[model samples]
Target: MATSKDGVKLDKSTPESVWKQILSAEEYHILRQKGTERAGTGIYNKFYEDGVYKCAGCGTPLYKSETKFNSGCGWPAFYDEIPGAVERHVDNTYGMRRVEITCANCGGHLGHVFEGEGFPTPTNQRHCVNSVSVKFEPKQ
Candidate 1:
């Protein structure tokens, strides 16, 4: 299994049965199958608590809560990520062109990121992420 820069063991090459045993059905679909949850229906769509967001598949830290913003796009939106936390791909599925973002460590699907929108972020990018693809660790 591949590991992330932060030493999180990736779940790649694990059996489907093993993944099914560890992750919820929704989580597997989003993180492994690259399926997206419906808009405005994600648990983190409106959640803005202070903490870090980690990849559900490997527990690698992805984004700090301070980078999250309300994009009104339904899913959790982040303007930035922890350095080297994710990889990018070109996605042309569903007749739309998008940049697909995945966990750099385990290669789990996090979601898509878009650019050129006029958002008040340092990068002017919006990471449209799936709630099922991540787990939240609250700050003390």
Candidate 2:
């Protein structure tokens, strides 16, 4: 397996069959197929601990626990990313226009970002992320 710049193992080049075998059904759905976990059902929805969140698909570090907050959006929410860890794209699916967030290294679909919500953050932005798209690592 190849590793990304942040030292995360990447399986983006792996075949779909291999991915299905390696990942859980929910993880494969959200991370590889660009699907979304249901509202309020994500493991990290109410989780708050000191750690880092890594991409489930490629293991790339994406967000710090400090950046996480309870937005009550029924998913893990972040005010910011670990700079350069993610990329943004214009999503026009489902008859809506939104910014899609993805892992910078493996291009795994993370979730979406919204602004102008007046969150108590420097950027005043909300990065609504799917719990299945990430794995949390507590600080040692």
The per-prediction CA RMSD against the true structure, in angstroms, equals 3.6, 3.3
For model 2 the local lDDT of residue 23 reads 75
lDDT of 1: 0.89
| Residues 27-57, model 2: lDDT tens digits | 8888888999899999999999999999887
- Per-residue lDDT tens digits for candidate 1, residues 25-125, read 89989988999999999889999999999998878899999999999999999999999998999999999999999998777899999999999999999
Candidate 2 lDDT for residue 58: 75
- Measured with C-alpha atoms, the lDDT of residue 104 in candidate 1 is 89
Task: State the lDDT at 38 in candidate 1.
Answer: 96
TM-score of each: 0.90, 0.89
